[model samples]
Target: MGVWIRPEVFPIFGAVGAVVGICSMQLIRNITTNPEVRVTKQNRAAGVLENFDEGEKYAQHTLRKFVRGRRPEVFPNMNKYFAEKQ
Candidate 1:
């Protein structure tokens, strides 16, 4: 008999390829449209790059920003370490 592949494998491959394609497209789009990457020497010399500020403020919104910036602690839940005894 000739070579035969199971039909079930086709959809799995298709789904994986679709996910990879979407992720790659998103990565490319982010790289191309990133404000920091597009900064020019002239803008830097002029002392005013609009894109720089936009880039800095890209994701400074809501709770995620605060959560990402929190200082790491060995025992985050041990508040008594810093608190004085009452």
Candidate 2:
């Protein structure tokens, strides 16, 4: 069986969709592209450090795996510990 859309309503749907798409794109660009909505330099610096530590941890694991030619030890499943630690 085939579905049917009224030709008259199809254009209206397209017009509404275009308006919604434009508005959503504009909102996303305004939030992401504009600097005022972004994280401050201090916060970004902290984020950089956090990510660096995470990368270093992975690099260490890779070194252990290759240098010793052994499978890496699986890290224990830890509770989520970001921004929630005392």
Candidate 3:
């Protein structure tokens, strides 16, 4: 014996499927295209560093990353050390 859905219910199912498909497509597009939805640590750091000059910003970033808590005293001499490197 075969189970059967009503003829009217078939069209309703199609309509609901279409709606679900469209909504899923829209959700995928929003996820892929939305800039605010995806932000990485590196991207955020780059954004923050954009305000400074490239060379100096990298030097400062390196110093901050390696020497922040381990040796806070070295922070004050960063400019002096970078100056010697050049």
Write candidate 1's Cα lDDT for 2-82 as tens digits: 357777778999999999999998688566656555456664566545565666665454455767867666666675566
lDDT of 1: 0.67
The worst-scoring run of ten residues by lDDT in candidate 2 lies at 75-84
**Ranking 2 against 3 by lDDT, winner:** 3
Where model 3 places Cα greater than 4 Å from the true spot, the runs are: 1-4, 39-86
Q: Candidate 3 at 10: error in angstroms?
A: 0.8
Model 3 weakest 10-residue run by lDDT: 47-56
Per-model lDDT? 0.67, 0.60, 0.63
Candidate 2: where is the Cα deviation over 4 Å? 1-5, 39-86
lDDT, model 2, position 44 = 54
lDDT of 3 by residue, 1-86 (tens): 13576666878999999999999986885566444444566665654333336445434555477766674454658867887999
Query: What are the TM-scores, per candidate, against the unseen true structure?
Result: 0.41, 0.38, 0.42
